[model samples]
Target: MAKEIKKVVLAYSGGLDTSIIIPWLKENYNNCEVIAVSGDVGQGTELDGLEEKAIKTGASKLYIEDLKQEYIENYIWPCLKADAKYEDYLLGTSHARPCIAKRLVEIAKAEGADAICHGCTGKGNDQVRFELAIKAFAPDMKIIAPWREWSIKSRDEEIDYAEAHNIPLKINRETNYSKDKNIWHLSHEGLDLENPANEPQYNKPGFLELGVSPEQAPDEPTYVTIHFEKGIPTAVDGEELGAVELVTKLNKLGGANGIGLLDIVENRLVGMKSRGVYETPAGTILYKAHNVLETITLDKETFHYMQSQIAPKMADLTYNGQWFTPLREAIGAFVDKVNENVTGDVKLKLYKGNVINAGVTSPYTLYDEEIATFDEDEVYDQKDSAGFINLFGLPIKVQAKLKAKNSAE
Candidate 1:
């Protein structure tokens, strides 16, 4: 026996699962008014006519909040600065969840709703990300997870529910390849992807929005220059752009050259391994370019130290849904300090899916052409290496000498 919920703000996406949740919530909660809150984070056409669809499916009202800029600047930029890639994933979908869930909480408070709901499946990591974000933001707010509570077990059941309730869905959209998209990246799962051994068909219908198959890419090389200021990308190809636009511009260029396609079997936070193919054209370019700049700007010790923590910190923060936590904030401060002189231009050559670094330059570059030149220069004395090597290898020499003395005795 659960307490009665008068109203709930559903984090709706106008997708199959969310479309059904509207009617399902009403039925379970004695016909409660479900207010749909759709956070638009560069989902493109997915937001088209969302309000009408929500209202027709039994939602009392719909709130379409444009969170694209906030999503890019607040969420995406922080993760990018931290180089936060979960298990080598750019975390496009994982990072966006917290922003969405936080917005859901804001909508819940604004609407004075009794509970907040999301359409995450019980078997997936998103449920944890979404719920934990909700908990962090609104500790007292009731969370209604339909997948965990309701009897609707599969996509078939959800589609059936949608039909019975006369909820309009995109009939042409193929359900074979389940996908999630945002400005940063697009993730593909389900269908043939469920089996790890099955080779992904680039020719699969409805696939390849951000990239052509590597085989289909142009044979010619494409070069693009990315400009950075204090580690954050400010412009691409001389055009100053905002966070979303910058990513969008780079995604187009990277995809044209078959740049950012990754197939990996990753450890999900829910204690399971899932295989997914991710296309992160813009993210890939940014990552490679940023690292190139940091090479010249960051000291060897600091760079290596931060490099060691990049993966683990990314996994813990992204997986645990602590995108806005103090720990992440502290890490960001350190990363920012490391990027102080990361200001520079990186020219990368994209050829048949490979992003090869062409050239890099920075005002703070520690590389001295005169000192590093192959030709002779008056910069240093070569004989100094004798004393330096002796000092450097002193401990090893002493240990070896002791071993020889002991053997003789």
Candidate 2:
């Protein structure tokens, strides 16, 4: 019921599902040239052999774009500024998908590709993410999802297909857990994680490489100072660095101190529950530091309102893969306005996975030392509270007086 696609650009990651997808698309789509595009959004050195892997597995060509800078400056920073955390998560994996999908659309248009394909499963949020971004950018582009169309039901079937087609896969029987990794965080799912009652052995050291185990962390405390200007992190300790460098430094320092580790069962947009372990040391540090700075910089009412209303919506939008939509952009505009004076410095002590706030200060701070002093102060009058309390409790006093008079009568 769809138009015939000549050449397809597939968002390939060289995983089990994507490996089989390359050969599968070629076989089914009349042997179309499947151009593979992998977005290098801080996957580290894992991009080394990705191009070769794609080509060998029947891709006509491969495009690996370095999106680390864009990812940090555009996507991650905006979410961080808004304090966008989905169900208390920093939205590590979800935030990266839109940027990657956008690039895929760009590559498709440049190559005159008839269709865009992905390996996302039918039930997952990524299928919605990749497709929505594609639709947002290039509405007319034909979308192909192999998992929705294919007869393959299990990972074993995918392995068999890859073997038959000579497609190299990175998965094995031992490392059965499926993971999505980026600079922000790493997500673990599948296997035992599907069952909520199963005790996750995240404590096993070397089980994952993102950060150290809490038990394995050093007993001695590590101190770090974060400097922020308008809610954007500008420096670490006293050294000024760019966005990439600062996050990398914090990741190393925080990871060493075991400062980030999370286990949560979250509700997916697709109406299913998923349990995942995320390690985001740098993100954890950044969130805490930003929150501390806001305490000094933001006014009580506006800050509390934004915290209660705007923050959760931003988190929900990011988690639901609505990054490229107008609502998110509008929210970002509001967030930028609110963060205009959020400049400050926060000193923290990290010990055995605990990040304790030592102190926070800012030039734009609303904390008036003169008014808050218990000792003699000139700013606030002590007698003003009597009149203020009388007016404040007028309704209560009137109600009680009326009730007493009626009872006496």
RMSD of 2: 1.7
lDDT score, candidate 2: 0.88
Query: Per-residue alpha-carbon lDDT of model 2 for 1-409, expressed as tens digits?
Result: 2337889999887778888888898788888889999998888766779888888878999998988889888999898888888887889888899999999999999999999999899888999888899999999999999898989998878888888887766677667788888888888888887788887676765555777877778989999999999999999989999988998899999888887888889999999888988889999999999999998888898789778988899988888989888999999999999999999899999888899999998999999888899999888899999999999999999999999999999
Cα RMSD of all models vs. native, in order, equals 1.7, 1.7
Q: Residue pairs in steric clash, candidate 2?
A: none
Model 1: per-residue Cα lDDT over 1-409, one tens digit each? 2347988999999988898999898888988889999988878888899999998889999999888889888887777766767778888888889989998998899889999999988878888888888988899999998998998887877778888888888742355466787888888888778899998777665688888877888989999999999889999878899887898899988998888999999988778889999999989999899989988888889888777886469557886677677787788787778778889899999988899999999999988888888889899778999999999999999999999999999
TM-score of each: 0.95, 0.96
Query: Largest lDDT belongs to which candidate?
Result: 2
Regions of model 2 farther than 4 Å from truth: 1-3, 398-409
